[model samples]
Target chain A: MTARIATITSGKGGVGKTTATANLGVALASAGFRVVCIDGDIGLRNLDVVMGLENRIVYDLVDIIEGRCKLRQALIKDKRLSDLYLIPAAQTRDKTAVSPQDMIRVVKDLKPDFDWVLIDSPAGIERGFRNAVAPADLVLIVTNPEVSAVRDADRIIGLVEAEEKGPPKLIVNRVKPEMVKRGDMLSTGDILDVLAIELIGVVPEDEIVTVATNQGSPAALDPRSRAGKAFREIARRMNGEDVPFESLESKDGFFGRISRMVRPGGA
Target chain B: MNSGLAVKGVGESLLIHVPAGPWDEVLASLLQTVVDGGEFFHGAKLGLQLEDRELGAADLGRLRDQLAERGVNLWAVLATAQGTRSAAADLGLALDMGRPSQRAMQPDEPIETELPGDAAVLVRRTLRSGHHVHFAGHVVVLGDVNPGAEIIAGGDVIVWGRLRGVVHAGAGGDQDSVVCALDLAPTQLRIAGQIAVSPERRGAAQPEMARLRDGQLVAEKWIDEHRR
Candidate 1:
């Protein structure tokens, strides 16, 4: 199977790129696709903890890229999904330890067997970000509803476009329905109007996501989590399934519309 | 086949030296070069030097249409062929590059002054956070200037789209310089020695210009009163 390399990047930190990458890998694998998630944040390794594979990583991405071990030996298989895998990053080395060409060669080796290769990009538009997107067939930019987050997402989108990786799809994470209903937060429409890209998923804010993350299990594996459900739909969309988006705004939809009309223009 | 296309920056526009050969092959390679180049050709005016290559009106029209689709304006056509020259005339294109003295040998060199007095730099894309656009001349942006970004210009600053970032216009201590944007909501505005923050927006977005009025920075609607 030819793997589609999708890099999840956010120009700002703490925007849930790792969570989305882990969840997408789980959801895609749950759907019977062979998925491998690579934590591109080398020094700040966390995908292993999010995927519950931290203890099993004997050889990290640096090891494999540095030719210390075979590609198969470094892949830590997920306990829940037989087909899902985790290629954790080195915790000690900085982003300089790996290069874009190294990522391309490593991804090339993993391409023959996997259906999907998801990369968790680090924050900032620097060497780490470049390493993640170098081998990507598609890019998924993750951003929150805040102005700061959306602004960084715009920067990341520009860089991705500059790299000629095609237009990256957006995943707006941590939307609070209540806040949106109360006219206190930026709506999906507002973000879309600014970014002007295709929306693949909109994950609502849920405390269970934090709980699930701390538990070392992706929420996408849980049947009851709302954010998990959003990620599952993202995975389905990645698999070429036409799943309708869940309504994140209040049912009235009137408050959101009025807020858009009266929102401050410049400042 | 790929040698048929030579794309380079000349002053503010791009000059393409179109080599003579099979039209189809050269056209394919030319299109490929622009597409693969990425983010460089957007909003750029193109001058094609088609030497000794005769072309019909329809063929010239097709070329113009293709370049236009990619946000490139075909401003001039330099051709020695008489038929190609007339076809270009029918299309309202300039035949000569006009003195050719303004042609910059190095792409990234500061633009030689062409305006009556002031020099300017044109940026065609959004400058996101962490982006710092520093220029010695006036600056013009066709896209948004998001927060956390900074634009330092030696002269006036103009943004066709939103301007929410910090801008230091007239950085060379010219207090007479001005800053204009479609949406003037900069986090902080600096003109020479003066500094001011944008007042909170009250209503819908409108073009606004900021300048030093009696030693104080004021932003007003870009109307007939504020004509450049």
Candidate 2:
């Protein structure tokens, strides 16, 4: 089966792009879709660490692109999922080691065997970002609800439009519903009005995300994690499933009650 | 009208001329130019230079009527033939445009009026962060101007969509310049030498126009200036 390449990017750093990529890869592979996660961050490679597969890396994406090894030799099969694979980035070489053409060639080589190829793009709109998106059939821009992150997302959206990969979907990460109910933070509607794009997912700030990353396992594997549930919904949506968005107010707490009282129409 | 129309901007208005051709073809060609001009020739006084061509009164009247339908005024006719001049006179059209200076030298006229000159640029895309749109003329954007973006115009700036960026409307020190947008909550607004930050927005946004009021930038809801 031909694979659909999707690139996850955040113009600002620390906005959960790599985390989203790893979780999506895990979720898709768990759903019987053969998935491969590519670390496009190059020198600052973290997908392997986040995916809990850093110890088995004998070859990287550079080695495959440079023809030092066969395509299958560089692919590291996940310890849990037999069909899932990880292609770690080279730590010694910078982003210049792989060009956009090289990314296309590598993706073409893997398209016949996989169902989805998820590329985790590095922060900033540079060569690394270009290499990640050049082979993408769909682009997902990750951003925070803060003003600064939204501005950078807007710039990246403009650049993506310039590349003729228009109308990228947005994933708003680290949303604190308490601050939003207090009228102190920007809401989902506010961010959407500024960026003017489709919303794919809204991941609430959960401490389990930190726990999952620290343990070198994605949160999507946990059944009780809120962020993991959100990632699962995002993966289902990517698979063309009609999944209803869960309300952030589902957590019944003192803060949720105060928020519902403050804004009666809030979801 | 087809796009085979030659439109040239003269001193104050447009000069649309036609070469030697058939009566139907020339009229069609001339009318096409006026129609294809779109907003660029809207309400513009046109001088149709029909070099030595002879035309009937009904033909000239039909052309004038079509131009009037598009909001274009056929004010002057330039021709050497007697028949064309007579047709133009029958429709109350000017035989000669005279000198452009005569219109400028008219007494009791508003000489300081802002003429539609080379002082406006229409941007049809959103201005994202790190996008600097600096122009010596007035700036018009049809999309959003997101935060961290900056618009510097020597004249006024108008945004058809949201304006949340930093905008300096009168960079050339013209206090009369203004900034208008569908949403007027900009991060920073400057006119001439004064600078003002937008107040925290509450409730809903409305179309607002910001201009210098007593040497300070003041944003007021726009509710049809003619009605005001």
Candidate 3:
């Protein structure tokens, strides 16, 4: 199957780029698609740990690029999902160990085999960012609902446009809906107003996500996770399905009740 | 034979024109000139103009490192070749000398002649954050200018949509230059030497024009002649 390569990048660090990549890979693979997630952060490798495949990595992306290992030997298959795999970044080597051309060459070889290739990009618009974007057929920008994060997302959108990659979709992660209702946090509308891009999904802040991540299982695998459900919807949208956006405000506990009482109709 | 290299001062930096020659010879002569120039080359910003000379990222990176070792900063690279331009850009080098007219034209010196037709750039798309547009003449944008973007024009500036970015009109000291926008709320606005931050809006946005009045920048509602 011809795979569509999607790179997840956020200009700022600690905005759930790795978490989204890992979760999306699990969500898609659970749908019976062959998926491979590559960690593009070479020096600070974390996708393997997040994906719970760190101990299984015999070879990595740098080794495959440098001809030290075959592509099959480097791919560490997921323990839970048979068709899901990961090509972890080399913890010892830095970003300079792999070039943009090398990334393009590696992605080219994987295109015909997997149904989806999700690349987790490093923060900043440096060599690592360029390398991740160089091979992307689609780009997904993840951001938190804050001024600095939105500002950085705008910059990344401009750079992605400059690269001539089709308009990148947006995923607003770690959104505190209760805070948004209280006017303490920026709403999804406020973010979309500035970013002016297509919204794929809005994930509410969930403590289960932290538990799931640390347990080496993505939130998408947990049936009761709010964020997991949001990720599943994102995966469906990625597969060309028409899933309507779920309202984050309706689920907020006391704020939801008060808002509904004030408006008379569901927010 | 001539070494085929030329260097001249431009504002705060030196513009070096690299002549069409063998890559090795060109680089060797460039290093030799820097060495021969002594203290003049040290701590100086160099803008290398390579007209149609193709160079890869490795070559440009090496040259940048070599220049850095000599205490010379490689600020910009002006090239006509696509390969060379992309290489320079990938290396985080400025592609052109931005807003040269800002320094060249003196505010006190008045223009003595009127051109046949004044020049202006018409941008048809939104200018997002980190995007900068600098022109020597008027600039007319048909889309929104988001915060963190900037426009420095030597003449008047006009925006058909929201104007929320930093903008400078009459940058060359033409106090007569004005800025007009449908939604005239920029992060900061400047005309000639005067600067102002947009005040908080009390209601809906409306078309407005800003210009220097009695040595102070002021914004007035844009009223059509026929409607007035």
Instruction: Give each prediction's root-mean-square deviation over alpha carbons.
Output: 14.7, 9.8, 15.7
Q: Candidate 2 — which residues are off by over 4 angstroms?
A: A250-267, B1-99, B103-119, B224-227
TM-score of chain B of 3: 0.49
Which residue pairs in candidate 3 have backbone atoms (N, alpha carbon, C) closer than 3 angstroms, thus clashing?
none
Task: Report the C-alpha lDDT of model 1 over A181-219, residue by residue, as the tens digit.
Answer: 677999888787677677788898988899999998999
The local lDDT score (0 to 100) that residue A87 gets in candidate 2 is 98
Whole-model lDDT, model 1: 0.87
Ranking by TM-score: 2, 3, 1
Among these predictions, the greatest TM-score belongs to: 2
- Least well predicted 10-residue stretch by lDDT in candidate 1 chain A: A258-267
Candidate 1 chain B, run of 10 with poorest lDDT:
B97-106
Instruction: Write candidate 2's Cα lDDT for B49-157 as tens digits.
Output: 8889888888888888888988998877888999998888777787766433343344875655555565478999989887879998789999999998899998899
Complex DockQ per candidate: 0.28, 0.53, 0.51
Model 2 TM-score on a 0 to 1 scale:
0.75
Descending-DockQ candidate ranking:
2, 3, 1
Which of 1 and 2 is ahead in TM-score?
Answer: 2
